[model samples]
Target: MLRIKKLDIFVLKSFLLLFAGTFFICLFIFMMQFLWRYVDELVGKGLEINVLAQFFFYSGLTLIPLSLPLAILLAALMTFGNFGERYELLSMKAAGIPLLRIIRPVVLFCVFLGGMSFFFQNIIGPRAQKQLWTLLVSMKQKSPEVDIPEGVFYSDIDGYNIYVKHKDRKTGLLKDILIYNFSDGFENAHIIWAAEGKLELTADKQHLFLHLYNGEQFENLKSQSVISRNVPYRRETFKEKHTLIQFSSEFNMVDGSFLDRRSDIKNMHEISVAIDSLTTHADSVGRSMYSDIMSTTYRGAVLTPADSVKIKTENIAVINTDSIYNSMTSQEKLKVLTTTENRVKSLSTDWDMKSFLTKDTDNSIRSHRSDWHKKITLSLACIIFFFIGAPLGAIIRKGGLGMPVVISVLIFVIYYIIDSGATRVAKSGEMNIVLGTWMSTIVLAPLGAFFTYKSNKDSVVFNLDVYAAFFRKLLGIRQSRHMFKKEVIIHTPEYAKDIEILDEISKDCQTYLETHRLKGMPNYIQIFTNNKHDDAIAEISKKMEALIEELSNTKDAVLLNLMNNYPFLSVKAHKSLFDNRWLNLLFGIIVPAGLLLYLNIWRYRLRLEKDLRVIIKTNQSIIEQIEKQQLYLQK
Candidate 1:
């Protein structure tokens, strides 16, 4: 049995609210995207209210799987971001609650969401997609609303291009109308000119009724007779005339059962069944084609007992076709060559046709296989995105929609790009479908793990200062120090001890310079394998810092100003290449990278020598200033 704590309840409540809101927001966004893609189809079809509602409703249902992952990602980010911003996360951690424990409730909820996503994708999504796509096709096939504008050719009507010069808005009359009708064929076109006309839909709405006044109609007689030149036509003038054109304005739906054959409009079980059937059909077709080709190739061949013995003894007779062709008459040779060529071409064409039979089956198998993997991959994406978003939010410590929204969108875009690119490649048969389908998950799982680890350890993963310092050290950039004279002396420097320490530091620097040749390149082996330590530099730095701390309290402005001239030494700058011994050894084993690291180490070694030189010169100068002050005081 599981017990629910207040903390768990608090976390669940916060996450659930954000999840619900973000889910709908994501759903709405994806639905709008769907609408934008098919807006042209839905706009002029004059679909009923119920039909339009069903269209949007089915589209939303199909988009639910896509929306779920992004929604989870945004919600997780916002939930944890709000917690971190308000220091609630910090307080929980302060109470000995780990980051993972704090996020336990949300993680469980994400798992539940994943299951829900799987259910929808495997069950409801297929049916909705079928309905949605069927409706889209119906909408696209449906005719546009009849709205003929003035001074424009209205070609939306099938087989007719009607140009209206003017129209009476109140009377619903078209003036100076010119029409081209090629319903039968272009050669049998009918051109008409009418002084006035009016168009209206019939009662059944399956035909357009055109009433014309003072119209002259010209009907081409070219199609009536097969005359090559001087084609004749018939003409008629009428005071009033009516023509019935086949134009269906009523809304009609197409048979949606055709969409059942698509891979996307199938459940996991259906896809599996499809894949198996296709594979079996492809195999049988391949075996049959192979047999046919083999039989055709060896159609007239026979192996005698002597030829079999020759085969066993590896002494088969070789025929010289050139000599045989030379022995034959020209007509006989041409007859044989023609027969062989025809046989070869016939076999090639037959093989091509047979190969096409299995090609479609193989493609169907691949589609079903890819779709099967898609259901599982989409389900796993929800849980994976939670790990990424929650830890990333805690690291950024930014709450509300502003920062989290931007970050979530960027991450989701990256995921979408990878998923879409890989899916296309996989579907094209250029890549293994399973690997391509899982490529996005494989790429992001490690990132999620890294973020979670860093968040749990409370690492400053995005601290710019830390990164800047590392790069500065890597590039051997010099840093300056600032020192000031104290207003009140808390512990004034013992000038005698300070002088002695300065002398000691200068001697140690001189000794180190003499012992180590810092101008030369670092040893490759030592940089990688050996852990190089500079005790002299470390000790000198320690003494220099201690002496500076004492002298900073000095009332003498000159001595205080001179303290700023001390070089800030990096005590471990000349240490081993990395803190990890194994990693250092690995780098050493990689020759090209080891050479680069070797040169970088040499640069650090050179920088260390310069720092020591500056430290020694500055130390001597400070010592002379202190001695001069003492000498003047003694006088």
Candidate 2:
């Protein structure tokens, strides 16, 4: 027990070290994203140090859940990778330590972290998001700090474009200023130019005042009321001039109370409550609007009691809209129709707007529910990542940050893409919110478990050799060499006995080839029904193998080489007997089975014919050598 604990502690220490590094790295990445998204709000706002610090603080907190899972994934990957790369995993496994036992400590730690993440998401994270979003929104309304550059038209101001050829920043003096004011509309405008000017902000910082010296103003005095164009223009030269532009420089925060708390900023519990409230409200609104439309259009007909529906009463005066219109003067008829049309248009517009509102409410409800599920789902991701990373690392057996980082990033990207798609689906209400929010976890959890299972069983899931072979076969670019261990033969062949056997096998093969026509159409039924004929091939194959063995025994290099040149009998026999199932299925489907079987038989016959030719040539050569040896022996 003590030894096991020590081992687990050692493994955990390494994992934690990597976790610390990776967690901060993940957080930094998310922080950079936050910066990019809100950089415009932060750049020239002149925010205080405390405010900026607070933003970073909340941003980091809000990003914790996101970063935790990735950190765990990377840490587990790195730790196990180190183990496998160094062959420490091999030693442990040899010592009977299972993969699960090796990763137990890290798994427990991840679970603990997952719980902490949940706590933060449910309790602390909401507050941080609320504050962060509030601050960001506040900065949006705050005016951009004054940064007017020279040689460019500054159109940050509404309805105005002001340009300065040169400005002395130290002295805060502008030279050769041009300002265009289109506040009254582009058709009528005022153009102002100054030899020298100074820009200043009002005491309240609500307005920008441009004080100009030796300037001129041009105003086009063409009233929109006048039909004629280019009627009048006014240009005035002045010793000094002042124009005020509306600009708010103060930093005013929006009321946080008015901000919706039911957004993603809410905690799971709060979100659930919000969902319930929204659902009830949406139902009530839809019911009320539909009821109003029906009641107004049909005058309570649809709301009739069951008893009234059943009653067959005498003929009643029905409303004849055509006759009512005919009874009226054209003016009165026009008025009545105008009123009815307006009423119908109003009802239809109201109905459409309400329907849209109801759908929007439903979508919001789904979003909130998804957010609630996400709190748990993201927390669960930490655990899932640990299982995945640890086993994957073990399988890959790569140490350091290089391969592990690449793998972790790829996995996380896949996960995030799936999560994003699921969230969109949930938001659109095409899928159940619970399933949608948990979809990534659902997909990933089993994969992690499978990796664990493979690791525990010592399965070669990441054996590059296996993958390489598969791809090689797929591309038809590689062949595998099956090595056979050479045997140490104690005795040389009895040439007299081996020669007789080889002669007999050769004669049989030659006769079978010469007498049969390989080009004939095959009886496909015989393929299945004629196991009898198949055994004959097997028998011939066995006899061929015996001859090759005898030739190897002769201890003659030339004869051994000849035997080596011959195809393996087992390979030739089975080649026609069975093929890749995919090819068989393809042939069976695309062509009639009889034709396919016949074609296969024809192919096999041709193959047999070739093999027989090789055998016959080999036998002839051996027979000549035996005759020469016998004559020498007689001499």
Candidate 3:
């Protein structure tokens, strides 16, 4: 039994759900298209429904290795996205968990999955596929006796024309059966005629037994009179009646020849040899040459003049400069150069350098020329996706089905496109196989790690300052200009005028309240006055609270408030007071926050839709939001 830790389980469940969902979604879409195109032909050819179903089922099995990595990648992204959105990653990191530690289980799981995929690709998958196709072909070519219609000739089955007057469903009997045998030439063909026949299914259902009574077998022997044998037979049995189909035997095992033809083996051999030489005492010149060859081979297929010539010339120059004849005259140096050139030329010619280079290149090219490599490449993609998804999830922090899905899809699409293009180039011998296969992972891994690192550190990648700057740029708007002087200028008369208006309202309200306190005033007047004051206070409080909330939420409360209050200030004033430059610089910090929010929403929706779909399909009661959360947590 496999024991999964709590955290591992969490990661696995998340990854599995994501992987299964993505795989099935794609599989369903593609399978539907495939089935739609072939279903009619299959049915028209009188194929058994069971066999057709098995064919599709096996087809999905064949596709598993191809889809597994994609599933892993998508699942990793979704799982990590959800974690980031939920702040689980942040919480873990805050608890002193390393990013590598957090991802350890996921990486291990992917390796395990990759191994399983290899087993399927090399073992079970091919066999199942071969069997399915064999059955399908057999079914298509098989003849039906009872199902044959009257008058209309049915020739879907190869080399046979079958016609029957009527069929009895219960007895599985046909009234009149006519089978035109075309196995031999039509000129010398025979006809099978039966007055009444019954078809019985064999135990395995692979063969059918036809029992005929009172039938005549007519034979047309070329250059002889037509021979008709009338028999009053009680029962005549036909053996091996079911269609005999043949399937390719090669699909049973991995082709040894295919593996031997791969260039990767050669590369591996060279690498192994280099490692061995490096470990033990070896000639420095030979070692250097091998090392250079390995590097060139690893980088790509072709090596131009720029690759080896520069290093060779530099080495020769250094050797000559350090020679014992260095103190000799310029003429002596010329003699040494001539001698060195001749030696090098002789060495090159004797070693057949061109052929060696060509051989190495060919070996490198052959290494990746198998379909098996595709499976391996896809399997390894799991790691790439995990890195990308985990960090992205943390940054986005909004893990529902909306933006997270969109972002995940976009990222995966980019990775897939690059990977696929690289694979093609590699197959064409334009690039090295290992480099091409791992290219997408190399490019995206760092990006994922960076995001995860920042997220773990509680750093935002995008902020409101960026939004403000963006808006300003888009609207072609500059900071407001305060045209007034800095010094406060107050006029006594204007201040007095404002004070007079305030005093008048205050006095009137006080006098009215005092008068009402003594007299039994109208109920309507008292109610109206109380309502107006309450409403005014409530409105003021609401406005203040809203502003306070907005400011609290902002990255820079003081600067944001200032910008809101003073719209006519110069750009310089805004920059000075609010440190707008820093704000602009910190704008990227909010990107992670926004992305987190977006992913959270996206994942939530996807989860909800998935749950709802499941419920609908199972005819279960609608699940509440809290219940759904519990279910997700439990899984």
Candidate 4:
């Protein structure tokens, strides 16, 4: 039995609203990019409104799969971000509903969205891709609308360059026109100058009609010339001349059947079939190439006794070809060398062609295989992106379009870069097709899982202070303690106890420094192998901190300032790099990396020694100040 709660409906409604809007936004953006790539082909073509509409429609359909993952990512981020921002997520968690339970409905919806993405890619995308390509080709072939500008040569026509000095738009009359007709050959060209001409397109839009009022035509009869430098020309002066120029302005679509050979215009089943067929063809060609090379190039030689001498065991004795070459005449040697060189060259060229053929077939197979995995990977990417975006939104606790949009774009860009690079390498046969096609998924899935786990457990995944502290520990950076005089002293600090603690801390620091040889460099091997804790330094640090805490309540500003000067000590700064002995040994075994790490450890050791010296010095100053005040009170 299934029950739909108000929570599920609420979550679904929020996500669906955002998803619908983001899907269209992503689709429009991708379509704009797609159109920009072929803007040159579409502009000036004078395509009809319905044709342009169909182009956009098919383009959107084809880009639906690409847009789905980004749309889901943005929508999930915004949905969860809004929830967390509005305190709805907090209220739900407080009401005993975990983050996972809240997001379960959205997850299921994302799964459904993934299915829809796969459907669009497999069923609708192929037809849209084919139609879009066909329309683009048709647009490219269609002639530009005829509007001859003044004073510029219009070479958009196939074989004619027409220059108009001035033209009347209302009456469509040109004042001065110069035309170069190279339709016959460049050498046999015709140049025409017209005083006034009117250009019109035929009803079928296939040819240009040029009616000149007064013009002279010059024809170079180079083809009729018999000798060089004796070219003849004919000049004709006419009052009225009508010239028909061949220009096809009508839009004719290319046959899309040829596009079927493309891997993108195929379904999974078709791609699988293509892969099998290409693999089989490639294998057969390789086998045939091997057989041809063996049978034709390496055909066994049948020899008589004169060609080679036979031994007692009926095996021919080996002969030195250099000795045989030395015995030959010069012309015979040259002839034999020429023949061998030609044969070797012929064999090399034939093998190269065969190798290229085999490589082409293998590339095709890889392409088909990559596309086959692409369909499934894109679908899975939708779900992966949702998981990532939703959990990240919850962790970041950012709502509205600003932060969510930026994060979503960043994540999607990373995914797109990985997928594109991997797909290219896979197509080039440099990597396994499956791994390359699914590389983005593999890289991001664990990240999504980690975010989900962190968000579910209400962990601090993005807290800057936690990471700052970690980096401080890693770099052995010691922060100065900030102590100030309290306005109201809960318990007055006893100067006698503070002086005693300082004395003990100073003594421990001196003893540790003397025994541990703080001034010298640490032994590299001992640094890694030894896991001993510096209990002496730790005890000194513990007492110093406790004394500072007690004296922080004192009304004396000088004591507060002196307490602040005591440096904060890190207990494990000079300890073994790792707690695990095996890891330490392994790091030691790696020479280059271990050397660098050992140097870093030695630097930390030096810092630790310096901090201990500073502590001892600061403790002596504070002790002297406390004893001076006590002696003043007695006086």
Candidate 5:
């Protein structure tokens, strides 16, 4: 038992739901077309309902192998797309899960589907197709009701018009039947009229028989213009049956041995027989060539002796001396040589004829061998189609009607084109069958593998990044920058100016307090003072008024502007300024006290020195002293 993870189970469930929907949608659409095909046949040939139903059923079964792969591809793509969109894929990757591991279940599912397809193709598919074809044949045989729409001219079994006044559904009978038999040659035609008719199914369910009563038959004979025959009482019947309809041989044949006989077996037997014939012919040609060569050689030897005898007889005639002592003349000797040469030439011609016959036999044997190889190659296409479909679906990753249909059609088209071309070449004796039929599979398998690899990598080859990169290269756009070196700078002269003004005001107030404290109270101070320091109080009040007037009169518009701008700059500048260790320590302790006390007296001294440098056009040593003092405090 396989223990599936919760996530894997969820993924599988989602995929299956999608897959089932796609499969059924595809199946229904295909089945509709299948039904339409038979419907046309039924209408044209007047077929039966039972046969039509069986035709659709078997047609549905035959199409399952084609639809399964499409469903699988669609389901997988949707499943993976959902995972990717939800960031589940990212999560899984972060958790150290490999993509291959995630898709293992999908691959396993596809394998199971492939197995089912194989079962259907090898066993169920063929049987279903055979049954469907049988049913169609039977329907043709059983000439059922010709469903003619009212008021429309519908053709009868014999390709003639049939008109019905009315039809009784309960009785399955028509009140009137008028048939024009155009089946006969156009010049000689016949018209059939029946008062009433009923459609009947044959006892064996192999044919539909039409029974008519009270009818007249009219015919136009070529020699005799027109003829009409009428009867007081008449009975006519029409029968239509499919000739190819037959029971399986096993049912008819009593012998169990004959049950195995089939067309496929006969085809195989024919091929084997052809091969054997070719072999026998080759062997016969070889033996014939050997015998012919031997005969020619022996004939050549006999011809030489015959020519010599003739030559000797001629030479004796040419000689005029006594028979015992006479010698052949030069002309007689030359004539003897010429006769021998002609005999040798005749033997060589016979040998050449034998050689030509042997070459022709060898060529015939090679041709037959090529044909045998081609037949065997074509027979193995079923398995090749399986490989092509399964892997291709896995790679495409789209299993629904839309993508699957387009892809299946395109892939099959290519496969068919290649296979057809190869077959043509092979048949024409241009190439061998092994190369032709298997070539398509060999080419497409790698393409499927490439797609599968891309799919597994979660790579969308047509994505924005890919397109951008392509165009970027085409336009030659290339530049690089160091992002880390760029820093945001903040300037804060406003805060320092505000601190200088605050220091001046604090110093003047401290000087007034010290001067008042040094003076003793006058004698009448008790009378005016709420406590007994009346004189001191009056003097302090006068001095405080003077100080307030001076402070108010002092134009600190620049300091006010500085104060207003400091808040805005402080937030921005704090991080950058405090990033330095010394600045962080100094400001962290002093800034809070300085803000509370308004104690910018030391800061004002530094500011006065800066103002002196600007106004007097002279370097100020006080600014240096302030910086040195602040530095010493830090040390």
Candidate 6:
């Protein structure tokens, strides 16, 4: 039997409360998004309160798999973050408790959550999905309530358009009603205008009755020849008239099996069975298509006469089309050509439809198989997210919803993006369904293990200074010196004079740019072929660094500010050469490389121009600051 310690109970109590709140928060967020999609179907249909409640309930249940993983991730991040922020983790470490030992309870609970997620997916989720969609389809089928306002044309009903000039909602009456009925056909349209009318639903809500008083009706007589310039029509006047329209207002749920047979409406077992059945059916259709192609299209078209099998036409008469066409008179030939064109068109259309059906069926099978793999992958994601979130929170050591929420949401968004992309690829048969479905886990599990290891060892995995240094090295950039070294000044003179050092460097750079033709395409081509620009740029960079170093000994604040701006000039010809060499080698010498290299060179040129501007401005500021310092000393 297992034993429970006080520490275990304490951790569990705190984590479970946060987990429960976070789970519902995730559910509410997803439900809001769900409502956005189906609001059109639910609203204006006047569905019963219980019916709406059932719809939302089923929708929430169906979203369990999606919400569970995100919830676990956020809950774990918050739980550990709170512990780290409160110094509980630090206290535990000082007490000789391992990080994993502290996290053992949360891990066990997450494992149980993962199992619950799996059960929800396999059993409750599918039924909820079926009921949700069934309700949705039923809502769409029910007639929209007749709330036609005044002075507007409403075309909600099929094959009918109605206009009401004035509506009296209190009296349930419409004045000056105009109705256009094209149910028979557009050419045989019937138009009715009424002085006053009332629209009401039948007791069973299966039909609409329009009772009109002082109405006139006119109907076109389509029996007249279409070539006649004038259409024959009939008109009638009535003191009272009525019409019955077929409209179903009741919400009748579709046969449960209709959408239940869809890929989304099944567990892994059912989906696997569907996959097999669809596969077999698809195979049979393909084989039959291949047989028809071999027997019909290639009947007499083979290169080898002996190998070409003559397709039999039992109980069918065959005619020599070419000779018969040649023997036909001109009029007869026209008739034959027209008939043949129609026949060919019909055959082409039939084959096109068949090809479309075959492709659709193939995609359906892939979708089913992909959904089957998703059942397991989604459950696995909950455990993966817990592993990642808990260790990362421990390593970061900051608490509450601030940093933890951002990190958790960022990680989950990345996971969702990868999972969505993989699902699309799998559904399109670009990759195997299982591999695509598990791609996120395969990519992130190692990362989770690494975080776990680092957290257990108390490593600063989220340390920004370390990462900053590494990034600088990777990009071949030199890091800036934040602290200035104390230097002994051998001479203290001339604070009033203008600085010639920055001016000289700026002059040299401007002169070099003016002399060198690094602007246009011709100059770009010339530079790469034993380019002297590279050597010149490299020399200028060295001089700039040397100038900044000598001036670093100065105690002038403006001079120090100017020195801070000099390191940006380090991003020059050398870094671009080596940094982009990998690009050229991978993309090759011509085509993509040529265009890309050209663009990169132009970008460097723009940066060089910006550097010259900075140099000139810094020299001017140093000159002004020195003048100010000299005036202050004199005062």
Best-fitting candidate, measured by TM-score? 4
Estimated TM-score for each candidate: 0.87, 0.75, 0.41, 0.92, 0.43, 0.71
* Stronger candidate by TM-score (1 vs 3): 1
Where model 3 places Cα greater than 4 Å from the true spot, the runs are: 1-158, 192-196, 200-219, 224-376, 399-439, 446-450, 453-635
Per-residue accuracy of model 6 over 1-635 as CA lDDT, tens digit each: 66889999998888888889989999999999999988886678878888889888999999988998888888888888888889998898899999888888888888888888888888998888999988888888877887887888998777889999998979999999999999999988999999999999999888899999999999988765657788789999999998998877777778777785688889888988888898889899989988886776556332245433332324325546688679889999898778768867876886898799798988888888878778888888888888898898787777788998899889989998989999898888789877888898898889889999999998888789899978875554556545364477765434433366556767877887688554544343432443233566667677767766666666776667756765455444522444344453444356566666656666667656666667667667766776777788789
- Which 10-residue window in model 5 sums to the lowest lDDT? 566-575
Clashing pairs in 2: none
**Considering summed lDDT, which 10 consecutive residues are worst modelled in model 3?**
568-577
**lDDT per prediction?**
0.87, 0.80, 0.55, 0.87, 0.51, 0.79
lDDT of 5 by residue, 1-635 (tens): 87789767775687678778867866787788777776755565543455456667788887776566545544455555556556676687678776666665766776677667666655566467556555655554544454655555675445456677778887776776676666667655666777777766566745556677677667765553235352232344443211122211111112323322222212334545655776787788778877866775664554566765886777744533355224667787677678769877987887788778766654544444443443333333333433344334434444445654565566656766886787566545567655754576567666656655665565675467778867754443322211121143243224234335444434543554455332332222111121222243334335433432332322333322222211101111111222355543454357565342222323332333332223122112222333454476589
Off by over 4 Å in 2: 1-4, 40-42, 168-172, 182-189, 202-204, 220-234, 243-246, 296-351, 464-635
Candidate 1, residues 262-320, lDDT tens digits: the string is: 99999999998888888887888888877876665664333456765776698646856
Error of 3 at 305 (Å): 43
For candidate 6, what is the lDDT? 0.79
Candidate 2's TM-score reads: 0.75
lDDT of 3 by residue, 340-417 (tens): 688667656745875575555544433334343555556666666666666666666666667766876787678878
Show model 5 residue runs off by greater than 4 Å: 1-8, 44-53, 147-155, 159-436, 455-460, 464-635
Give the runs in model 4 whose Cα sits over 4 Å from its true position: 222-225, 299-319, 484-492, 520-532, 554-558, 577-603, 627-635
**lDDT by residue (tens digit), candidate 4, 293-321:** 77778652223445434443567457577
Q: Candidate 4 clashing pairs? A: none
For model 3, give the RMSD to the true fold. 24.0
Q: Which ten residues in a row have the lowest lDDT in candidate 1?
A: 296-305
Which regions of candidate 1 deviate over 4 angstroms? 223-227, 297-357, 471-500, 521-529, 548-575, 578-590, 620-635
In candidate 1, the residue pairs with backbone N, CA or C atoms under 3 Å apart (3 or more residues apart, or in different chains) clash, namely: none
